[model samples]
Target: MPNGRDLGQDRGGDGTAASMIVTTKPPPANSPGKQKTVLLVDDQAFVRQIMWKALSATHAYKVLQAADGMAAINLMRDGGIKLEHAAGTDLMEAAAGAKIDCIVSDINMEPMNGLEFVKTIRVGMASVHRGTPVIMLTAHADKHFLSTAFALDVSGFLVKPVSGTVLVEKIERAIATPVALKSASDYATLIVPDVDTPDLYASVDAENEQSKTVRATDMAEQFSQQRPRFVAISELKVGDRLSEDLLTTEGVLVVPKGTRIAPALISALKDLSEIVKLMDRVSVVNV
Candidate 1:
């Protein structure tokens, strides 16, 4: 994979090729209705063109194109898509002025992969960029890639060779979905922590004081009467009631408390154990 600097050279000096492909004409000022904007990033110009045409055909979107992850970030930071004649401006100022509804990006590109770009936007960029919905386009559907995408809070995922119609539907869905902005600490908890994980408890403790208070109150209320007994996860049996919610290391809720153990639930928990170890011990109330 070529780095951003190398791809910049490949696209004619200084990365002007990607910038030039963006529509130079600004959307009509004071137009009756504003069109939702989408940023499309792919290394291949042809792919970008196809997506641009497909999205534009809806007459519902104003499209922007980027050749790679680096170019995408630059465009996003610069505010609205740069026109051939427009004056340069800061991204924060532009983002404040105009909102971008969605981003559609390919996973593989030189200099900055889609994953890196998404991470930058989600956790490394300004608040304006952090919560924008993203739909990842990729040919690969392996668990590793999918898990990574989900961990970073990607709004949607589409396998490649998708039709323009499908693409448009995905874009709309992504736009309509609520954005759950995540912090770096949240990401770490979900992606890295496991059983024997003192790290998980530390993260929970480190959350904002208000959040800590709320969680403490909730836990206390739920476990007040029937305190849970910790047992090895492998020893769980049917008819046992969960004492608290089971969350993956990523903090995704797996099973809510009070759920009676069942074979299917056990099977699902076993699968989760392979990836997250949920927790070393199962907390259950005697039934």
Candidate 2:
């Protein structure tokens, strides 16, 4: 119920007042045994604290907290600040420079909402985590909200007051699922409308029964519209056409849409994927 400064009474384990920024150092960067890092973004300190406690309990994740979407973006851009234990034990020698594996964010927040943050990541081009999985947490589960969230490439959605166990499971699933398997249309289908709608075609036997038919030809025409198929660089073939623009994290355009894939281009894309985290899956249309 409380938003922002109104929840100042809440304090973390370090006796620090819950403010706009509250972060704990995770394992050091590049540690062979480092845990996966998850950015938990929410305006309410108490809610962040609850999720943090749940995540930390498992010792499986290094949790980072941000008050809102803007704060989360700033943290991502700046890498992350390292905080030492009260006894002067440095958990991180430098800033936690590890890439955020996933994000669990609340839909309602000030300055920039959760959906705005995701859109920024997708189009920002300069962001290394542009393709990172995002799990949205919302108090409202209306169809409009679900549709809008999926359009922005959200990986999963959880209503408020979510249990700790369920939150962890969702994070695991989000991270495990490849970017190629995430589809806006497929996710949107999860939101079923209240009105009773008949299947594509069915026989009606009501008092005022009126049977309607859908033309298979029209459906075939719609399906004929070439759709972009996402494939990993290793899976790319010579005849595939670029269905989406490909850009590096530095905002450099590597390949424009509509370019036909070639053997040389496939080799170059493979090299680029190895050099940066940006290009795991490329959208292409088969010739």
**lDDT tens string, model 2, 150-268?**
44556676667868997898788777764432233333233222212212111223422321124334433443687778987678787787676565554444564555565434433
Per-residue CA lDDT of model 1 for 1-287, tens digit only, reads: 21111112227556443532354223455545667878787887777767766766555776666787777777666664433312232122253356778888887776777877777777656334677878777663222354456556676666666579878877777777666555765554433222122122223334466765776677567667776898877788876877876665555454556556654344334434334435566689866
> Against the hidden true structure, what lDDT does model 2 obtain?
0.57
After aligning candidate 1 to the native by TM-score, how far in Å is the CA of 210 from where it should be?
Answer: 22
TM-scores of the candidates in the order shown: 0.56, 0.54
What lDDT does each candidate get?
Answer: 0.60, 0.57
Candidate 1 residue pairs that clash:
2-111, 3-111, 4-111, 77-91, 190-249, 190-250
- Reference-based TM-score, model 1: 0.56
> Which lDDT value does model 2 have at 44?
75
The best candidate in terms of lDDT: 1
Instruction: Flag clash pairs in model 2.
Output: none
Instruction: Tell me the number of clashing residue pairs for each predicted model.
Output: 6, 0
